[model samples]
Target: MEFLLTVLASAVGGVAAGLIVARLTRGNMTGGLLGGMIGAMAAHFTLYPSGEQALPGLLVATLQGAVGGAALGLAAGFMMKKKT
Candidate 1:
């Protein structure tokens, strides 16, 4: 249950980050979305150990996920941008 919640939070964070990055960079939304998801999940797992449960922990994880998502989304958006 907690794991699922973490994933869901991470995904939501990722989507928000992806959309923001896409809009800002005028880049590929698909790439940003995928990158955000992957980065969020990676950060969540890397930062939090299993069996931890708390409101603060969840909030921190979500923030971490968002930061990770934003970073990867930005990278992906730039890489996928078409040269003008």
Candidate 2:
């Protein structure tokens, strides 16, 4: 169940990134978290849709997932800000 574990870890990473980014940016926590979750899942599958178990691929995928999650989280945060 390495694949399952990998996805789970990625999901957890996404949640953590979402919460941290939301808190740091003072954004909508719920929106940012949801965006991060979706972005991470997309990154994970987009990188490894074939389910390859290569170490390098996994590393790259995970890194990209985190980046994607962060990007989405940041976007969500910014969108939540008032137009002051």
Candidate 3:
């Protein structure tokens, strides 16, 4: 249950952050969400320290997740050969 909550929280936070970042970066929200989810999963597995839950707060986790998501999104965007 805790793990589920962590993933859910991270995913939601990441999606929201991704949306905001994408808008600011002149990118697409849909793709951003997907990338954000992936990033959130990665963060959940690798970034969170032992005994820490997802992150201290939504904003911090979201921001970090957003950074990762944006990176992935940008890479995807470049690979797709689409103009933003």
- Residue-by-residue lDDT tens digits, candidate 2, 1-84: 678767766766776777688889888888678878887887777766877454234455566667778878778867876776
TM-score of each predicted structure versus truth: 0.81, 0.77, 0.61
How does model 2 fare in lDDT?
0.73
Error of 3 at 9 (Å): 0.7
Ranked candidates (lDDT, high to low): 1, 2, 3
Worst 10 residues of 3 by lDDT: 73-82
Q: What tens digits encode model 1's per-residue C-alpha lDDT throughout 1-84?
A: 767787778777876887688778887888788888888887777766554553235666677778888889888877887888
Segments of candidate 3 deviating more than 4 angstroms: 48-81
What is the Cα-based TM-score of model 2? 0.77
In candidate 1, how many Å is residue 38 off? 0.8
Write the number of the candidate with greater lDDT, choosing between 2 and 3: 2
What TM-score should be assigned to candidate 1? Answer: 0.81
Per-residue error for 76 in candidate 1, Å, reads 0.5
